[model samples]
Target: MTAFRIALLATTVLPVLAVAQQMDPSMQMPGMGAGSTTEVAPPRTSAPAQAGMNGDHDMGAMRGTTSSLPRRVGAKRAAPSPAGPLASHNAGTMDGMGGIEAQREMPNPPPPPAALSGPAHAADLVYNPSDMATAREELRAEQGDLRAYRVLIDRLETQFQEGGNGYKWDAQAWYGSDINKLWLKSEGNGTYRGRVEEGDLQVLWSRAISPYFDLQAGGRVNFGPGPQRTDAVIALQALMPYSYNVEASLFLSNKGELRSRLEAEYDLLITQRLILQPRVELNLSAQNIRELGVGAGLSTVEAGLRLRYEFIPEFAPYVGIEYERKVGNTAGYARASGEDVGSFKYLVGLRSWF
Candidate 1:
């Protein structure tokens, strides 16, 4: 029983001692009244004191509180922002963040889009029909230029033929100056007539069908004849190893009559410029020998061999001999009229051209 009482007493005393220890010494002074709650000013609220201080207050522990008091009221705490657009409007009006008045400081409005532009800029902005038309015209001119060049190439390549075959055409003109002679004679008779004659000009035209053949036409004027006899000749020439030429002619006289003559020659080339030619000429007339007294009647045949040496490829000198025979009424006229009708002839002359 004594032990229990002692434990109870110890517990009560411990509580009393804790209460005494917590009491402020200054409040416990002699004049202080006991058993009364003294009214004390809680430490003034501080800028950060509210944040740091807990409810347990010791007035004696407040150091640096006086100096820490607001110098002026802290520039008023920004009110909690109102919601949404209202807060944005209030913020925009604040002097620190200038109002819409800031727009007044901007430069005047920019000029039109043309103000700082170049041709490329204009091109981008432009749309017009005239520009399209100019482009089309340029394209057409280019096409025409290409076509013209093509035509020129075709002309050069063709050398000009009737068809599209591209075969070339050629024409040639030639002149031959010749001295001619004829001798006429009657077979089985002593009568003979001979004459020396020459032509002033012989003009010919020829078309080369190929390398080997030629088609020819020409005319000759016999200036040696006082009456001016002329002849038109047609021929075909074959260029063989021994070149062969055949010609048919119509002889015209002052008397207004036409006589046909055929002549053929074979030429053997002895050199590039020299040739040996064997030739034959036959003459026939429409009338009896009595009509043309000088020509020894009607049918005449002459054959000869000639040697021609070309001084230039286009010119040559020739010497030949020919024996001629006159037949039919031509022999009769010559016998009765005692006219010089035909003979054998040896002649020299030039065969030439340019």
Candidate 2:
């Protein structure tokens, strides 16, 4: 029994000594007499997390020793966040609000000065106003909204078809402002040594309806081989999406004849100066005006493809293949007169504008 008691005391006493040795040197033992001069052992080597937990304690004078505590006063503070204010941006929004302008109505801006709102000729202020006015008048006449005239010889060429070689011309001239214009168009075709087979002149007034189209109203006079005729014309010229050009016209003749025409063209660019143009035209009539050799249904269609190279933008020389066919009653009339109803023609032409 005496040996057993000795072993129990040894075990308990050794463990208590070991725990005391591992504690911080300065910390006092609980329930132990004060000023005993017993030295505490150095801290034991342990895992970092265990060191942190062990380092944190209620012991006075030991609080600053923990590695988790900030060394400098400001080091523990988080960074300030952004306010998303206008000055943080380029200082202004498009509506002219600056700074933190939320929920605030923009104040009315001051009106412009009288000089800024008046005629732009500021020379009138320093020089003789009348002389400056006269100078401004001359400038206005030579510039801005005044030089609105264009004359184009769109096609003036000869055709080489299966039957015989022929020549044709289509030209237009217009003079006016952006919104309104007087337009003249004429087209005629004839055999090289023969009379004009078909010809017409249209004198029209054109009004812009949209950015891409114009509405035109006018008169048309048909001349040449057919019966002399006068007709009222209404037309539309438009630039369709994908850059197609379209023209449609309705004609009501003095003899109560009704007819219509539609034309469409597209330009495909092979290079900066090379272009391929494909064009198609259809003519229709509601009644058979036999005197004009007209059709009751569809009358005619002309389709052509041309490749041109521009020397200057205003001048291009072209070579093309064209197919012309007379249809319906018009074809019957053409056949009765022994005229060729359809043919494929190879043509060379100059296209120009000034």
Candidate 3:
């Protein structure tokens, strides 16, 4: 009877021991001695269970425990946290493992202040109103006091006209500020062999009458082949519309001769360095002056075309053709003097300015 009781106890206890061993290593079987606590710990509540209880997952805890689980051979594991414990802890309550990933991908905050980061402060970049006004007034005063001068040879050319090869020069020089100027003007023409035909010199006071026009009042002295004559002169010089340069003048001589002249010129640009200039001039008289070979009505008409190539802004060489005719009574006067009534000539010349 004792042996049978022992056998029954062995069978029952052996099965119970097998079941206890099969349980989780972290869980202690009931009725196991208290000393087994050292070998096996109480089973911890799973991270998901704790998350359900507290309404927030603990990602750090999950990451800490996931490494111990049995995994398939090719299963991908969660990436390790690079931000360490604090970020992982915050990520747990927010967006779980994805929140941790986001935290890792977050942009870093801007660095501390340094030179050239920005202006020191708003007030430091602002200018005082009074100071700005003072600076502007100084600039205006400087501009108002500015002065300039120019000397240009308006025409310095040799002409081949009906009579003979001749040279002509028309030049003006001025010194002043924008509003007023002292002007000196000179013009002359002479034969190629040194016989001066006619010439004049004038001194004028010029004032700006418009944006593109000047009014001049002056005295002129005519000198050359004919008897010298002094005259009172008034003239208008203008940059007309379409870029035309025009000048018109009237003269009252000491001997009571009345004469007027009109001249116009235009430059057409063929290229950056090539130009074609066309010019027209007309002369008229109120009464005939016998000694001077002048006529009562129309005196003369001249038209010319010149093509020049500029080597620089200040200088050019040109070839041109000119046609001149004595008109009305002037033609009769020319005929009586044995001079041609009309003529054409080809010319070459240099034009320059500074």
Clash totals, every prediction: 7, 0, 1
Estimate, for each residue in 1-354, the C-alpha lDDT of model 2 and write its tens digit.
999999999999989877754454445457555445544344455588565653433222232343332122212323223542222344465454653485376577677686467656667768998998888888877675575899998788889977689998989999998778999999999997789998999999999899899999999998997678899999999988888999999999998889999999998999989999999999999999887777798999999999999999899999999998999889999899888899998989999999
Q: Which stretches of candidate 1 lie over 4 Å from their true place?
A: 1-242, 251-256, 271-274, 289-291, 294-298
TM-score of each: 0.35, 0.64, 0.60
How close to the true structure is residue 51 of candidate 2, measured as C-alpha lDDT? 59
Q: Please, what are the lDDT tens digits per residue for candidate 1 over residues 1-354?
A: 999999999999878655644444234446545544444323367768677854444322343233222222212222333463233345665685674567677679779887766653354357665786687678766663222110011000111112122211112233221111111111111111323233234455555566665555666555433355556645555554446666555555555556666768787888977788887878777654344543433477778777878887656667666566666666666677764456665645555443
lDDT per model vs. reference: 0.50, 0.82, 0.79
RMSD of 2: 12.6
For model 1, what is the C-alpha lDDT against the true structure? 0.50
Model 3, range 74-186, lDDT digits (tens) per residue?
23345656775355355455547877788899999777766457654433458775676687678766786456778887677877765467888888888886778889999
